[model samples]
Target: MDSFVNFFKKIPNKFASSAKELGKVQGIAIIAMLLALRVVLGMFANIGLAFNPYVKIGFTFLPMALVAYYFGPVCSMITACLGDVLSYVFAPAGASFTPGITAGYIIEACLLGIILYKEKISLPRTIICEVLVTLIGSLAINTYFIYMFYGLTYLQLLGLRAATLIPWAIIEGILVAVVVKALNRVPAISKNLPTT
Candidate 1:
């Protein structure tokens, strides 16, 4: 009972620490770099499966995940939002700009950031974060946008995306785990990062 109570108590402190850490110069620089990376990576990722133009599988998530791990949700959200807007400006993939998709990107980054920030990137955490991100960002949110703007059924979009996104999510979990482990080995970068 006491352990449960303490766990709940600690959650707020972790969030506070994460929020505070994002105000520093290093944090700002890291966020900027991540935003740029996301845009650059978007070039490679903008193309979707031929059958379904809404499903975009890409390597951009890795950098967003890293920003979340090192800087937390606030920075991650900013990076995601800005990256999406700029990526569109630089390379208009579809017919027009859809704010719903941009919102989905922000939500994805926030979810990933909240799940992985200040937490050791173990198999469990990595898998859980990837699953949540895939479901929320790719499946739920993206599906909605596609259905609304593209006149597709939600189920249809979900079914089409699942074929690729499920396997991609698993691979993403492994990739995130590997990157986290490698980053942990670099004290110069990881040492100064605040826990949570």
Candidate 2:
């Protein structure tokens, strides 16, 4: 614990200052690839879904958070919004733009990146963070949109969606932790660690 604390204290002086910062180049590249991957994933995810459009795999946020974690919360937020813009620009007709979805993605990705930017990257902590962000950040924002426009109180919508999303959320949470942790382990990515 003492060593850990000392290491953290040294971060700002050691890496944060001179550790060759990860600029917009990395951030933009990662986000662009992430957005493209999302489109491909979305295309595949649409198949076999008979009921809800929103219930498919939610892995898109993971990479944004990864970007944020490696870059910063502000970058994550910007990337998420940019992704929404790209998604809108590229999406075919009938797939209109949605500010609500963009807001939710930005919120979730920013929170995840901001929350774990300094904390030790344990799997448990990562999973908990993923769940917290998805539930409080993404779900809350989207549910409010549903409540305001679609006809449902926030709490009622929360209850309904929470219950419905429990399984999907759990699975995605695990997936996020696994995928991010694995990515973190990669030397190329880990070398570009967050600003302590």
Candidate 3:
């Protein structure tokens, strides 16, 4: 209803504010560094779980979440897209580049920004955000892409992806909360973060 409509209305303003971050040299440097980290982590550090090539556990989410926290949704979305594309370019995986998978990561970044930007980082909030991202971005969106590419039944794909996604989300949520809290203790880093 009205609240829902108002939420949509605010999105543009949020994006606008996020876009302004690009005007700052520090912002550009931070986002570029983080995006590079995301690409590297995605390419090399990912662990294939359950012997399923489709399912992976990676720390790429950390940089994306950090981007969301620092720069907001637009920057996070850009970072997500670039990270995926760059990873593919540097280390080609699968038969082809899948736009749907990139879309899933974009959704993940946006969700992270919406939940974490300018908000106090807490265990509950981080857990909820990660869970939602897992459900929507990984289980739903990425699964669809994987199904399309691999010709696997949707149910089978969902089951395989979910086997690790749930635990990974919870673990990642805890990690994000802890890392952000620890980072905030550093005056240099905290000074750069957006105030709630």
Candidate 4:
């Protein structure tokens, strides 16, 4: 479909914009701060759920989401990759390394950046973006990786994921909407906002 093609086309544009933005020292500093925040948040905020072996309720995504919004796809993706890698190293969430899950993080960050960067903050868009990321990254891709790394079957993992991530996605959508709207009040974060 034309929409699908256009969507792919937009990815490169977002990456190019991200690279350009990161060329600035301010941009690099912002990304480093976000990455460090993500790791710290990851270290402290994650609460492993007793109901699921792999599920954890965490607030680390907040910084990564901000990175996606304030920076661009490239920065968001890089931050996500490093943030996750370092978090696992420092925090040790009790899971072994699975590259597929790491890939999911990068995809999730880039997807959010692409959907949200330079766009107006809105409830509908926030919900849509969060749900898409949850479905694709958290549910599908992550479930696959979890199954590969752990012992759960795909169906079992999918069921467990649906139980946790659906509600988490709703909460994440509202949180992102609120935070982004508030951040837009700052001239720095709002600098990238598309002008009417």
lDDT top scorer: 3
Query: Model 4 Cα displacement at 166 (Å)?
Result: 1.3
Predicted structure 3: lDDT: 0.89
Worst 10 residues of 3 by lDDT: 3-12
Q: How many residue pairs collide in each prediction?
A: 0, 0, 0, 0
Pitting candidate 1 against candidate 3, the one with the higher lDDT is 3
Model number with the top TM-score: 3
Of the candidates numbered 2 and 4, which has the greater TM-score value? Answer: 4
Model 4: residue 142 alpha-carbon error in angstroms: 1.3
Give per-model TM-scores.
Answer: 0.87, 0.70, 0.91, 0.88
Residues 1-196, candidate 3: write the lDDT tens digits: 9966866677777778888888889889989999999999989998876677778889998999999987889999999999999999999988999999899999999988877777678999899899999999999999998898777799998998898898899999999999989888999988876654
Q: Model 1, range 100-181, lDDT digits (tens) per residue?
A: 9889988998888777777767877787788888898878887788787666678977888887887788888889899988
TM-score for candidate 3: 0.91
lDDT of 4 by residue, 25-144 (tens): 877887898799999988998888888767888887788888887777888899999998999899786557677889999999989899877666788888888889989988888889
Candidate 4 stretches greater than 4 Å from native = 1-9, 187-196
Worst 10 residues of 1 by lDDT: 6-15
Rank candidates by TM-score, best first. 3, 4, 1, 2
